[model samples]
Target: MLGSIPDLLRLLAVPVFGWAAYRDIETRRVPNRTWAPLAVLGVVLLLWDTYAVVTGPTSGRLFFVQVAISLGFVAPLAYGFWLIGGFGGADAKAFMLVAVLFPAYPTYYLQTTALPLEPSLVGVFSLTILSNTVLAGVVYPLGVAAGNLVRGRFSWAMFLGKPVAVERLPEEYGRLLEDADGFTRSGLDLDALRMYLQWRGASLSELRAAPDAHRNPDSLPADPNPPGDGSVVTDGGVPASGSPDQFGTAGTADPWGAERFLDDVEGSAYGTDPETLRAGLELLADADEVWVSPGIPFLVPMFVGLVAALVYGDVLYALLSALGLA
Candidate 1:
């Protein structure tokens, strides 16, 4: 019964992750608060599981070792991915939570068969989930390539992005292929634009209506909805400002509101910098169309990976085994 408690508790993560995945798709942001309760619960349950294993028979010591390995491997792996820009802060947090919540595989039986059709050889359940996430993530790029092929658009960039009219760009999610300097892989993030618009309580139509009116900071008026005690909610659902300190001394008079937005948000957080925003805005003003990469909402694949890991264990391991490589 004690063992079953942890297994059952782990199931709660499914719905939480599902909700997070939905939010990631809709807004591309998940609140930090979303993970707070889960973090607390995960720690408490981990401690309880630790006590159960330690006090139980010596044979159960292997579970303890598996937990240690899962923590040691997954924590650093998740952190490393975040450090290198391979993973978002939320993605890293989710992976770490998985490490804490289910460091060892949770057994589930269905009639005559045991679940987790293939278990991780290293006994690291978190690692299995990570592998499954990567495998699931590959499908998006392939679909993009296929779509581009059907449209008769053949280019290396087709796999990364699709061309959209500049007028429709503001409504779209993703980054621009053209920057201040010209075409580049590291495009300007649309989220920054959304954040700027939200901070100023302005709309894209207003920007398009009077492009010159909001172009120069010196000519711009005082912010109608300046960042203060209240937080500005961006299109992505991330708070534009939690505190005044985040904006530094960026004047609110800037018509583009680019200065304050860029000042407060980190480059890594949005995959854009001040120069990129400035240049991208210029491109928007001049260009008729631009290439935009609709980045995959990673949480979707992550949720899929979690479900796969729970059912199939390590998908990559199974594939390699079938290929006779493992």
Candidate 2:
């Protein structure tokens, strides 16, 4: 009965992760509230497992060791990934939660065969999930490459992004491949435009319809505390419109309200600076089409990883072992 508790707890993660994957696909944002109840439950489960280990046989101490390794190692690793921008806030939080909830692999039976077909030597369940996630994530790029080949659109950039019409850019998610300098891996993020549109309470079409009205500094409400950094403001005391230079001057056309959006919105414009946003907007306004990378919805692979971890144990470990490397 005590052992069954861990299995049940692990099972509970399946639906939660599935739901999170769905939400990630629909909207890139996931609310912090989504993890609250799960975090509370994980803590309770940890306490229960700790108590069970303390009173149980000496061999059960290994379970405690696994928990320690997960909390001490995987938790910090997840945080570091977030800090380095390798993982989003929600992705990092998801990994941390997995570390807490599944410190050690839970035992289960599949008819005649026992579950976790192959277990990791280190026995940290969250680490196994991460490894599986990485292996599963490779499929997306392979799929993209295959589609590009099938369509006879051959380019080195095929693996990264595909051509997208500039007018349809606002409707798409992901980053643009072309910038002021042309062809960049770390291009402008579309979310910044979405956030700007949301803040202005207007659509991209509305901005494009009356470019002058949106671009004029006096047309919109006055900013009480304008940025004093001089990044958005020009020497002429007006907001810098995207000029012909890298950072455009007020004389340049801004049909997308990029400069006004940067000036009005506080802080870095959705992970990009004011100048880059203006430049990227200028490129978008002038270009007929551009390449855009539809970033992988990481939660889908995470969900797959969770399932694979539970069923197959550490897939990479198994593969390495098969290759005689482990």
Name the top TM-score candidate.
Answer: 2
lDDT of 2 by residue, 61-139 (tens): 6887899899999999999999988888999999999999989888887667877878999888888998999999998
Model 1 over residues 112-189: C-alpha lDDT tens digits? 677677997777788788889999999888898889899998765788888889767656778887665666787777
- The collision pairs in model 2 are 242-248, 243-248, 243-249
lDDT of each: 0.74, 0.74
Report how far residue 199 has shifted in candidate 1, in Å: 4.8
Show the colliding residue pairs in model 1: none
Candidate 2: regions farther than 4 A off: 1-3, 199-203, 206-260
lDDT score of model 2? Answer: 0.74
Q: TM-scores of the models, in the given order?
A: 0.81, 0.83
The TM-score measured for candidate 2 stands at 0.83
lDDT of 1: 0.74
